[model samples]
Target: MAGVELLTGRAGASASALALETAATRHPGALTRIALIGNPNSGKTSLFNQLTGLNQKVGNFPGVTVDRKTGVSQLTPQLRAEIIDLPGTYSLYPKSLDEKVITDLLYDRGSAQYPDFVVITADASNLRRNLLLFTQLADLGLPAVLALNMMDVAEQHGVHIDIAALQQELGVPIIPMNARKGIGIAALKIVMAQMLGAPTVHFYEPEDELLPMIRQIRYYFNLHNDYLALHYAHQYRHIGFLSPDDRAYIQELTEKYGFEPTARQAQETIDRYTLINHILLNAVEVTRTERNEPYSNRLDRVLTHKVWGYLIFFAVLFLLFQAVFAWASYPMELIDEGVAWINSLIQTNFNGPLVSLLTEGVLAGLGGVLIFIPQIALLFAFIAVLEETGYMARVTFMMDRIMRKFGLNGKSVVPLISGVACAVPAIMSARTIENWKDRIITIFVTPLMSCSARIPVYTVLIGLVVPDVPVLGIFNLRGVALMGLYLLGFFAAILSAWAMKFLLKTTERSYFIMEFPVYRWPRWKNVGLTIVEKVKTFVFQAGKVILAISILLWVLATYGPPGKQEGAEQQVRTERQRLEQAQPAATHTPTENTFADETERLVASAKLENSYAGMFGHVLEPVIRPLGFDWKIGIALITSFAAREVFVGTISTIYSVGQDATQQTVQQKLSAERDEQGNPFFTPARAMSLLVFYVFAMQCMSTLAATYRETKGWKWPLLQLIYMTGLAYVSSLLVYQAMV
Candidate 1:
């Protein structure tokens, strides 16, 4: 099976040979690679999802923040294809790091894998702007096809486009498509297959007037910077090349040619615009009225109003959090019960050290983290809806006013909201903010948003201690308390941002320049894709950490120093023999049965005390004695560092290991547990203290890793870890001291 190769431009002979060899060795004719390029909001991704379904992966471009999405699709029974969704950009001329990635990949100047064939997705509603990019690609003389996307929208708006005429003018196949509705995909795929074996086609030649300008720019470019001139010339010859560097060269040439750089660049831009404008003038005709009504502006009136906007946004956020608890609670309970049942089934069916390890250690530990998927999925679902509907942009626009007071950009809203899901992605999302100071401040404060990782700890503690009383008429006290924790995080973030503003001095002008993409109905396909990707990420990323920790925890709780195992067995045997000897043959009546039960209890108690987990707990008793924590709780806390949800699993495992009877339930065992003084270990006060501890603790390593990657150094991550951990310790200490 031959695997697909992504070539940006026509690969050099040596590179081509190497790629072909690798593909042949890897999988002969088993793979096909396709590239999807489009102007922003052209529904390219929708089409990608429709084609690839769930078989996709998202990764970062080499040394850049842009996302590289690749997926496999079956175009025919005999043809399998790999599709790459390129970053959304207005033009090929790069302005941001993300745009540069697309340009570099197309030009084969960077490490980006090039596509075998380019699928140019153009929005029919905004064909003029879309065509500017399309024209540039066609000029590059590549084997390309055009996807005239959102044709339904164009028809509804009474815009007419001559597909045949357009194709003839551009010298490429054009397939009118409504990607959202899955229209014209079959034809597009057929065209792609047909063009795979076709020769490269050039669309248009430079005009006489533009030719002189191009030559003059190339001359200056060659004179001032020979390397850059040669680079662009090579790209121009092979890849469809248009870049900021080209524009810069042109501007510099104008300076030498007796014109201002700004004026000349502006003129060049306008000239290109004029040419595109004339082409569209001939190719398209609009019958609909030119309406001045911008949908975003109209929605913004209510969504981003001075007074009502903030109130509405906060109210929506509150509802979202409340729903995360209320709506997801039933599903969460189901998941928990399901896991518990499975554990019970496993224990009943098998009896051995390996079985015990598998059930109590691995399954139980993983269940702790997996059980929270419902809530995380719900949170992401709501976020996806908001984003797809364009409500999130309004959120940024409205929040910008408030965030500016604390010296943060409105764009920080995305990161802040993302933090609720997981601080790692939220931190990474901060790259979208253009200003350096704003980005840093956003990064610093993003972790303060109560992440989903903390929810497990919060939920366990809240259930254990917080009363389920009505606060006002409708509010639950427990829910209100949870809300307060979230608010505390939010306020802390604001305070941090303010402090950073004062400490870090930079004169980067903060601007609220964001495209308010036209509102559209939420595409279920896109929403589903987002949810699947996010949940998959959570499971795999967090699962690896939890699995490792669970194994280690199993070892620590299983093995003890010296002859502990032998001693425990000996104690159990002695207690059993003593009980058996005490039971007289004639005295085995109803009262005798009670006596025998008491004897069995004693034997079980002796076995537990001498067991591995019990002995280990006793050793750590001195260390956690001050904080109202026993050794079992200490172990739970340690495992919680992998993920907060593991607290429940750790406790369950510890209790089950000590009991030796796999049939015993965690809740039953927990309820019956006693401390050294023969009192219940989990008092209301102690549970509250534990809850407070978890609420503030920085226990998750993944969050720290993400923060490090986002901040580009350890300074921020280290500070976050130290500060959050310190706060957790101090807060827990104070709570326990006050309570006890």
Candidate 2:
């Protein structure tokens, strides 16, 4: 088996392998195109990851926004293949946008995505249900192979499969596999590199009433498979590859012959299932007649109990939030030290505007964002583990009831949860919701779920106001504060949705039906990959905005109207001299060293207050005063519109412009600030107020753009902006006034 280089024990397999080898020799540079298709959650993606590893990229298909993942797999030392992971669908009949992508690409031979061969992954335990999709693709006359995935799960259930018998019956090769553990990978690659046989047994043939219509379509399109021709007749309107004239021709013929597409499609499915069942009856057998309940089922009794389920879910969330803060603290400190070291080194060894731009502007701003990577990565890792272990599906199932009360469904939970990583993609995920009203409402509220971008802001502010003391002998108070802010956002989102339920009218209703996948240990490789990709997106995307704004903010804070800065500095000096003169010469005063330090601090503050950034902040200060925000905070509020995470960078660059970079971190700089009354500037009331504002504010322009993309208009986005801003302002005002 280790030396299985060619597919044997099947008729014509040797010749197929020979032909494949010859073709490879003739065109060594060309990649053999293969597609992987299966039902949703059938281990299709796991097999894909095994086959492709890190050699993958994601993009959109030709004309649609649905993700297209393609990767190169080396079948042999010399044979390489390009693998396209198509969206999972139950069958050929399309119901949603994702399923339609498969139908369109399969029906159109000219599509760039059309594969030279297909590897249909099926769940070994649920072969009866998974085979329906495999049989449909076989009937399309494409060269195909069936990879029986999840063999471990099947074996655990006391199910036994006769691989040879099933392959003989279906007239195609079947490889038993557990994709997660990389079992049977060598055999799969061996068979994949060989020429494959199309199914000799066609599972579905057109009935007499539909044969004429299908035949006409087959002849007009010069197609070889009857099932494919039938697909065009049934799905011409939705198929993107067909021309207007082609669709019209099919439409005209359908009406002329009175072809019933709905009836014919339903019958075709029924007929195929009948064939599949008879084939499996002799090919598959159960090893156990009486056995204890499976582990997953036993666990579900407690894990999915209505009352216990919710509690367990929240408990998991609590631990996750706590871990994010506790586990990431060391790495975050290291990053902080590294950034400060680099800034100090640059400042000591260099001098000029460009050096200032690099250290004060670029380093200060980007360093603020980089220090939080540990926390962000930890958060993403937790999420990835939840998804990998199949617990996320249970969460969705548990939330369906709650979601409906607020004009949403269980499907809305996915986007809202995804918003924890990013609102842009989370809003895009709303496409899975079919009902127009449900999707719109989901998009409207997804941004309110505190995303990873806000973690930097939240952690900093929470650390300022909330002590890091142990709670209940384990929990960190800061972590508790982080959880409270997230829960607050969640509550705000649902409450807003409930209010909108009656404000907007729609007759369309939506329902959610989902499957619970058996729990498995989290795949650490997949988890690692997810963290890498998410961190990259966060750094590259947010870093760009932070760098540009950091430079701009430094300019605004470092220099003002030529005469104004000088005048402000002179005024500070003049006041100091007047104070000295008023003091008795004999009165004890500060030593020369202490006096110089105080004078420098006073002069820096005076100049900054009159700089361009300060002038602009002063304008916004009056409006934000009710919320306990001062001029510097007002500047941050305005600059953060570009992105919420920029608030930290803006603060860093502003504080570092005229200060010693080596002496203090952003938190220390802020902690040492004072107001006119000589009170700590970032008091608990003001810190909490700012946190509340950010939790509700529509500060990310990317989210607004994503909303427009999802809703296809400014109508909803504009309303979202206005209502969210108003909500943030009012909420911040209330929190500040009450706390003060």
Candidate 3:
């Protein structure tokens, strides 16, 4: 028996790889653009990394928000090439947004980023199914090399391929590669650098019943190849090159030729496979030996077991949250102390009304955003490890049964879990789901899950409510509480999804079919890069919002009705004079005294009360008082709309103005806050109420922007905002009233 290749079979591999010893290798300067295209999990990215390491940029496609990655590969050190890595697609026939993005990028010859050549990656183990995409690319008449990746896995399963024979049959150079181990990467680079920008050659000349209509479209559209024209007939609705009139013309032809989309796609797929099978018969061989199921299967059997799978997943989550608190605390403290030093330095050197803005508005706002980097990085690191090691797929598989009940496919699980890091990208990730309703529902509820932006809010309030005592002598009570917050989000998402199912009506059928890649050791480089990139992106993106809003808020907090500031100053002066005069001669101390400290505090407090921002907060106080919020909390709540974590910066700036802005930490100032009655403002009941409020509220502008982009309308984003805000209000009201 031959070695097994999934979706097909393999026995062993034998061939002399291209060494690039040919005189054609000339390293003069930069080479032209080459696109790396492949099916999902085909190791194309790994090969790209092998070609270009640490020299990549992440941006968006023109006029679209899809992620685009381009890196430079040093083919021969001097013969460098710009490699564009397109998103993974199952086929050129677009079923999802990502697939549409790939097609738009490659098919538009007018675009600047169009590739001169392409490298089509096919998984050797899954050769039959992977070939479907390769065949489509070949039909476009772009010169391409086929990289059969994961050859080690194929050989291990006793799958054998005659590489030279397959190369001849396909009418293209074939390279066997194991990207994970850097096998045959040099050979791939040689072939890519050699043949790029040369004449366009195709591997397959597909014959179809639709040829007559295709020829008509080609003549009308002036297309280069019959298949290119045929694809216009196949997916003109999504092809960006086609205009409304063009699509209408294609539609007319479709009816004229009796073209059926499903039937044609099925026939083309079968024909391609039939053609591929013929090539495989003489070019491939398989020899099977006595071997039990692979180790990954054995692990999946236990890890994805009905009973144990759920339990193990929860246990992993528990440890993840617990570690966030433990590991991030040290860095957070350092950041806090550093901010305090900067605040003190500004007070000593700078004077006047603007001094407070620099210290509280800029430095404090930046600190608030930066302080959470450790926690954010840790969360993303865990997520990356799970993803890189292939455990995340299993998690999705385990959650699918439940996801279906809520009108979502297992694919929703990835986006929902990623929401814990940040909702903007999480909602963007939902585009992977083929169904619009599922994607929209996932976007609506993803914010309900506490993102990294909410961590500062949750942790700050948790300090005021939950103790740091150990639970069951193992888990910290605070850690358990945080985990509970995340769990609440998951529950809310599913319940909301279930309700929305009845609201949204669509004709598109939903399906869940995914291949669970074999588990492997986590790639540490990818893990580190993910953590750094995520943390950097979060900080800088958040810093921009925090900076602009902080300055505006400072202005709001500094000025008041002209007479009010003057009156407050007079009152502070009079109080200070009275205190100084009352002090006995023997107790007099000009430099430092308790009376001085007391006087300064009173002055700051009075100034804050009379500020314009204070008046607004006071006006809104009654509205939120039922939920255990004060005037300052009211201001923070309003500003949090910029970003949930902006709540921290808003509160920091406000509290710093009212107290000793230079000395105390934001948390310390918050802890010392009092009401008119002299009771703690952040009472456990009040803190818990706020936590519940943030947990359910959609207080992120970025998330709303992404939702609008993905859904392409304001209706869904507005509805999401309204629903989440209403839920937050009622829930926080109930909790605060009950606890108080």
What is the C-alpha lDDT profile of model 1 across 135-162, one tens digit per residue?
Answer: 6675554467788888877876678987
Model 2 misplacement above 4 A: 1-30, 196-201, 215-224, 240-259, 407-488, 498-511, 540-632, 639-692, 699-723, 730-740
- Model 3 Cα lDDT, one tens digit per residue, 696-728: 999576676567666656788899999999999
| C-alpha lDDT values of all predictions | 0.68, 0.79, 0.76
TM-score: which is higher, 1 or 2?
2
In model 1, the worst 10-residue window by lDDT is 1-10
- Name the better of 2 and 3 by lDDT: 2
Question: On residues 288-337, what C-alpha lDDT tens digit does candidate 2 reach at each position?
Answer: 65568888878888888999988998788668656765777789789978
Tell me how far candidate 1 lies from the true structure as C-alpha RMSD in angstroms: 8.2
Estimated TM-score for each candidate: 0.71, 0.79, 0.81
What's model 3's overall lDDT? 0.76
TM-score of 3: 0.81
Badly placed stretches (over 4 Å) of model 1 are 1-32, 59-67, 76-78, 95-97, 109-112, 139-141, 196-268, 288-300, 307-319, 404-447, 450-483, 497-513, 564-633, 642-692, 699-723, 730-740
Better of 1 and 3 by lDDT: 3
Task: Locate the minimum summed-lDDT window of 10 residues in model 3.
Answer: 6-15
**Sorted on lDDT, highest at the top, how do the candidates line up?**
2, 3, 1
The candidate, 1 or 2, that scores higher on lDDT is 2
